[model samples]
Target: MILEIQNLHKVYNNGTHALKGVSFSVKEGEFLVVIGLSGSGKSTLLRSINRLIEPTSGTVRFLGKDITHIKGEELRKIKSQIGMVFQQFNLIKRRSVLSNVINGKLGSLGTFNSIIEKYSDEVYKEAYNCLDIVGIGDKAKVRSDSLSGGQQQRVAIARSLMQNPKLLLADEPVASLDPATSNSIMQYFERINKDFGTTVICNLHFLSLVRRYATRVIALKAGEIIYEGAPSDINEAWFKTIYGEEAEEVEIR
Candidate 1:
């Protein structure tokens, strides 16, 4: 197993219970999709795994190490090994795509040094390679904000790959895009999972994308795991059970 979560739980300061003893294991190179309604602890769950939002109580074991409370350099080390993609497509708008991708090593290079550092030819090559992987090698010299929404998201993915992370966490990665663009953005993740052997744990709201891209599915409701199985197994009865009886199925395409 690449990751193991044993009896995880989280509660916010506002007194809302976010995650209720959620536990699951992930194998290496598996594309696992998380499905749930808004405020169902999907975002919280992803943040907790990377320690962006600490869990109220639980164990997050990655590569056989318990990373629930590690701090300082240790925490930074673990985080550097994990890449995260946000719904907002986090990127330095004023910077070039190549520069943003090179920033992926900021953690290892130290923030202070990164600001003044001069990258070598090898570093530039790697950044261009990452751009090529996302089908945006030609956009490297362009300002990040100048790219289209889908293209900007691709730049973010390229930046994440510069770290050569063992695992990638995508939180509502394509929620802001159109149906066609949503699938296009998702294909990059699928390619990364297959070609680079990176384990992906993505939070997705669209069942269509989940069925098309996810190898396995886990559904959450009110911070609890309601279902776990193959995407093909999410039949009509199971849909209502996961999304509630009154919820209507909406296809993206």
Candidate 2:
């Protein structure tokens, strides 16, 4: 297993218990999708894996190393091996696409050099290669905001790739795009997962997309895991269980 999470819990200052006692394991190279209703702690669970939102309790092991509470440079080293893509795309709108992608290496690049954007030739090449992997090498010099929503998300994926992460966490990556655009963006992630053998854990709203892209599916509700199985195994009864009886599954196709 590449990731092993045990009894993870998170509570906010407002007394909201986001994660009750989540536990799961991810094998290397699996495209794992997290499904849930709004406020189901899907985002919290993903963030906790990378320590973006520190878990209130429990343990996280990545590649057999405990990362539940590692600090300082130790954490940074681990972070460099994990990449995150967010719903908003999180690009510097005014910056060049190449600039945004190269920024993924900021953890490795010293603070002074990264802040000044004084990247070496090797760094530039790596950034360009990542953009190429996402099919945006030609857009390197363009400002990030000039691209369409799908394109911007692709840039975000490319940025994450510059970290050369073995694991990628995507939080509602295509939530803002149209269905067609969303599929295109997801295909890029598929390519990354297949070609590079990267383990992916993504939070998705649409079950259709989850079925299409995920090798394994995990459903969360009220901060607890309610379902864990193959995407094709989520039958009508299981769907209602995960989505609630009052809810209806809307087909994106």
Candidate 3:
């Protein structure tokens, strides 16, 4: 297994219980999609995996190492191997697309190099390659804010790729996008998972996209896992169970 979360729990400072004893394992190269209504802990769960949000309790083991509380350089080292893409395309808006992509490697590059913006030729080459993978190499010189939302998201994906992450965590990556743009963005993720054998854990709202892109599905409700199975197995009964009795499935495509 690439990642193991055993009895993970996260209670916020405001006394909100975001994740309640959540546990799961992810094998290498699996496209794992997390589905749930808002406030159901999907984002919390993903963020906890990468230590972006510290778990209140429980263990998070990555590649056999328990990283729940490791600190300093050890924590930094672990973070370098895990890439994160947020709902908002969190790019440096004023910077060039290439510059934003290169920033992904800042964790690996020492403070001096990052401060000086002294990226090596190899770094530039890798950034370009990542942009190419997402079908936006030509936009390297463009200002990040100048690109359309879909293109900006592509840059975000490329930025994460520069980390050379073994595990990529996407938190509602397509939530801000339109239906067609959402599918296009998801296809890029699929390509990355397939071509690079990267493990992906994505939080999504749309069952249509989940069924189409996910190799496996896990549903959360009230900060708990209500269902875990194949996308096809999430039948009508399971849908209502996950989303609630009054909920209706919304198709994106």
Top-TM-score candidate index: 3
Residue pairs with clashing backbones, model 3: none
RMSD score of candidate 2 (Å): 0.9
Q: TM-score-based ranking, best first?
A: 3, 2, 1
Model 2: residues >4 Å from true position, as ranges? none
Top of the candidates by lDDT:
3
The RMSD of every model to the true structure, in order and in angstroms, is 1.1, 0.9, 0.7
Instruction: Give each model's whole-structure lDDT.
Output: 0.93, 0.94, 0.94
Better model by TM-score: candidate 1 vs candidate 2: 2
lDDT of 2 by residue, 1-253 (tens): 9999999999998999999999999999999999989899999999899988788999999999999999989999999999999999999999999999998998899988887778899999999999988888999999999999999999999999999999999999999999999998899899999999999999999999999999999999999999999999998998898888998888996
- Stretches > 4 Å off in candidate 3: none
Q: Which lDDT tens digits does candidate 1 get at residues 1-253?
A: 9899988999999999999999999999999999999999999999999899889898999999999989999999999999999999999999998999998877677566577877778788989999999999998899999999899899999989988989999999999988999999999999999999999999999999999999999999999999999999999998998888998889986
Of 2 and 3, the candidate ahead on TM-score is: 3
